[model samples]
Target: MILSRLSIINFKNIAQADLSFSPNINCFLGNNGMGKTNLLDAIYYLSFCKSYSHIADSQIIRHDEDFFMLQGYYDNNGNEEEVYCGMKKRQKKQFKRNKKEYGRLSDHIGFIPLVMVSPSDSDLILGGSDERRRFLDLVISQFDKNYLDTLIRYNKALAQRNALLKQEIKDAALYEIWEEQMSVTGEEIFKQRKSFLSTFIPVFQEFYTYISGGNESVGLSYRSHHEHGELFAQLAEVRERDRILGYTTRGSHKDELEMTLGEYPMKRIGSQGQNKTFLIALKLAQFDFLNRNGFTSPILLLDDIFDKLDSQRMERIISLVSEERFGQIFITDTNREYLDEIIRKTGHDFHLYQVIQGNIESLKEEK
Candidate 1:
């Protein structure tokens, strides 16, 4: 899948712009707060129907603007596809495919599979368990459409159970109903997550090895209550305890993906560069996984990811994506030197743009 064109209006700092892209690479150059990252986020919104950093939809609209719009033209295999999104303050956002509105936004997710690696990815290690689980869900949601529906069902059940707990309901039968639902849906999610990680871990490790030259070994392990023998039984056992805490304590929502460097927790031991390397490798592996599983290679988005890396690591990343398997890429950077070196190393057709404030102009393109 290739995003051949993108049109935006009142999105973050971008006032209005329509631009084309190179099938190979499209690079954006700008300083901090110059709207480079927002441009990438616009493309990300087109794919995932949300922003990479997870801000409120209203906040994404340009200041003093009541509404925003984004449209993308894509080439999927031999078929042409058009995606459109429009939002207004205090109103529902409309998403359409080929100009026909979608009844459910979830249906549009995997249709344009994409993998984004941004500086915010550091949250995976530095942040809490929720961050890692989100990474898991985002990757799986792209390849498995029904996974999101299952997750939604599980969350609803968990919420109901929690609400009952908070209300101090004396009804054991009500508790049984939601607990049973949670067990069923949560177990399915657990199985799929486990299955995805079984194949994902090795690919992640391989990418890390190549990027870091195997100087240090990294590892990821899944932690879940499901392995404790039946989510239903565990939830029943924790029922009384959950009532005391006013929340359901045992479910997939509490599962975690632990990150490690050389057998120790990455959060405590990893230096800045090491942590960044870990995230970049992880995202590249995500791209690889979606490429192998999806109908076409997924688009790659890199948001200010070249900030802290050394020259060798950057070159390895450039070389890896330059290969044929990875498709269209959108990259944002503050340094011209890094983008220039990428152009030289990849030797692929590309478009380079300069972003100033909220405006974007095509500075150059190699046809």
Candidate 2:
């Protein structure tokens, strides 16, 4: 899939702009706070129907502006596909495909599979387990609609069960209802997650090896309560403890995707470069996985990710993606030299743009 054109209006710091994109690589060059990342986020929003950093829709709109709009023209396997997103303060957000608005936003996912690697992704390593769980969900959801729906149902049931736990009555019968639902849905989620990781971990390790030059050994492991026994039995055993804790304690929500360097946890032992390398490898693995499963290469987004890496590592990454295995890519960086080097190395068609205080201008096109 290729994003051939992008049009933005009142989206974050970008006030008004309409730009075409190359099928191979598109680079945004600018300094910090100059809206380079914001431009990439706009493309992300078109794919996922939400901002990567911002939580509230209203916050994404340009300050002092009432609304924001984003549109993308894509070429999917020779067919023209257009995605449109519009939002207003104190109003509902609208998403459309080929000009027809979708009734549910979840339907838009997987239609345009994309992988984004940014400095913020370090949260997966340094942050809590919830961050890692989100990583798993985002990757799986793009390929498996059933897995996405099961996750939604599982969360709803877990919420209901937690709400019951907070009540004074503590009706066993009511608790059993949600518990049974949780067990069924949670079991499905656990199985899918387990199966996915079994396939994913090897790919992740491969990328890590290539990017890190095979000097450091890395590992990824999945941990879940399902391995002990049936989720129903486990939840039942934890019922009393959960009641006291006022939450559901035994479920897929607590699963962990542990990252390791050699035998120790990467978070504790790895340096800044190692951690960044780990994350970039994980994301590139995600791109490879999705491209293989989805039957088309997912658009790749690299958000200021070249920082803090040695020249050798950067060259390895560039060489990896410049191959025919990858598809259209969008990258952001503060240094023009790096972008120039990448453009020259790839020797592919590319478009370079300069971003300044929310305004964008096409710098040049390399053929």
Candidate 3:
């Protein structure tokens, strides 16, 4: 799938902007704080219905603006689609497709698949388990709509059960009802997550080998609070403990995806370079999986990918991209020299845009 055009108004530092995009490669080049990243973030928001850089939708609105609007036209899996997002500083954001409002965010989820590789990817190795869990959940949610529905229902049940636990319930019978509901939803979540990992792990194994030149053996495992075969039974056993703790404790909500390298945990054993490579490989693996599954390959967003890589590593990555194997790519960098080199070597058709202080302009090839 390809994003043919994007329009942004009052988003971050960008007061208003519209840019036509190429199907293959689109480069956003500028110095620091020039809003190059914001352009990519806008496209991402249109696709995902949220921002990658910030949690609050209000923060995406430019200063003094009451709201922000972003829209895009995409050729999604051979279907032409239009999507729009509008957010107010004090109200919830709204999403629409084909000019009709989407009643639930889940209705719009995964309509456009995306794979973002930002500088903060080191969090996969160094950050807490929640980060990795979130990565897995979001990616899997895109691939499995039923998984997304189950996840949403499970989270709602969990929240309500936690709130009930904190209440002064005189009757123990009420507690039983909530417990039964929570256990049912939680078990479904656990099962879906385990099934997802069963499919995802082999893909990772293959791509990790491809990206690492067959030298490093990479692996991923799912860690859950319940035993592999006893998810429901474990939740039942934890009822008393959960009641005392005022929250449900054992289920997919507390699961993790652990990354390892050659029998050693990557968090401790992998170098910074290795971590970055692994994250990139993980994204590439996702791309391949999506392509094979008949979903459009995600729009690949690379932010400052060249900053942490040597020329050789950068060349390898560029070679893979230039193989004309992926979908729309939006990449950002401070210097255009490296990109120029890749263009010369690969001869791929790409549009170069110069960004400065929230403004963008297409640059002509130097004669």
Candidate 4:
């Protein structure tokens, strides 16, 4: 799917914008905080129905504005599609396809499969285990309906179990209720996660090698209590202990994706450059994983990620992203040097714009 045109109003710093795009590469140039990322976020909002920065919808509306709107015109396999989103102060955001509102946001997950690489991704390596689990869940949920549905059920069960623990409910039967749901759904979630990693890790390694020129090594190991015992049995065993802690302690909620650099923890051994490279490769591999699945050529967003890398890796990334398989890329950069290189390398249709204080104007275009 390709976003041929995007219309925005009162979203983030972008007061309003209606811009056409090159199906190949659409580049935005601006200094920090001039709304380049916000423009990309508008596109991201249409894709995921939420901000990538994880802020409240109320925060998204422009100051002094009571409502915000976003609409995207897409070309999918020669068919045209329209996606619209609107939010009013103190009201739920509405997302629609072809002018019809969605019954559930989950139904929109895979429709416009997208992968974004930004500086915030550093949290995947530096933040807690929950960050890594979120990475896993986001990728898998985009491609597998069963996995997404099972994850929703498992989280619901976990929340009920935790509430019971908080209340100090000692009835094993009461605990057994939610545990039954968690055991059935949790086991399915863990299996899907394990299966995803089994296929995902190798592709990630291949991307890391290509990006780093094979100068460094990386690994991702999945750790789950599911491997230790059946989820129900594990929950029963940990029940008494969890009662003391006041939260459910044994389930897929405790899962982790340990990232390693050359057999050592990435957080301990990775320098700033290596960390950025690792994350970029990880996300590109995610794009590859999604594109190969049912989603055809998922949109790719690169947001000011060229900093702190040597020329070799930068050129390698430029060469890699210019390949034919990747499609409909949106790139944001603080300067033109790297964007110029990418435009030169790809030799495809492109439109470049300058963003200033929520205003966007076309600087150049070629087709």
Q: What TM-score, computed on C-alpha atoms, does each candidate reach?
A: 0.98, 0.98, 0.92, 0.99
Q: Could you tell which candidate, 3 or 4, scores higher by TM-score?
A: 4
Q: Is candidate 2 or candidate 4 better by TM-score?
A: 4
| Tens-digit per-residue lDDT, 17-130, candidate 2 | 999999999999999999998999999999899988847889999999999999999999999999999988999999999999999898888899999998889899999999
lDDT string for model 3 (29-135, tens) is: 89989998888888878867888865688778899989999989988767888898898878888899988999898877787888888877788778888788788
Query: What residue pairs clash in candidate 1, if any at all?
Result: none
Report the lDDT tens digits of candidate 4 across residue range 1-367.
8999999999988888999999999999999999999988898888889999999999999999999999999999999999999999999999999999999998998889899998899999999998899999999998898888899988998899999999998999999999999999988988999999999999999999988999888999999999998989889998999999999888898899999999899999999989999999899999999999864789999999899999999989999999988899999999899999999999998999999999999999898
Stretches of candidate 3 exceeding 4 Å from the true structure: 77-79, 168-172, 365-367
Worst 10 residues of 3 by lDDT: 168-177
Candidate 1 C-alpha RMSD relative to the actual structure: 0.9
- What lDDT does model 2 reach? 0.90
The TM-score obtained by model 3 is: 0.92
Q: Which consecutive 10 residues in model 2 have the weakest lDDT in total?
A: 164-173
The lDDT for every candidate, in the order shown, is 0.92, 0.90, 0.79, 0.93
Q: Which candidate comes out best when scored by lDDT?
A: 4
lDDT of 1: 0.92
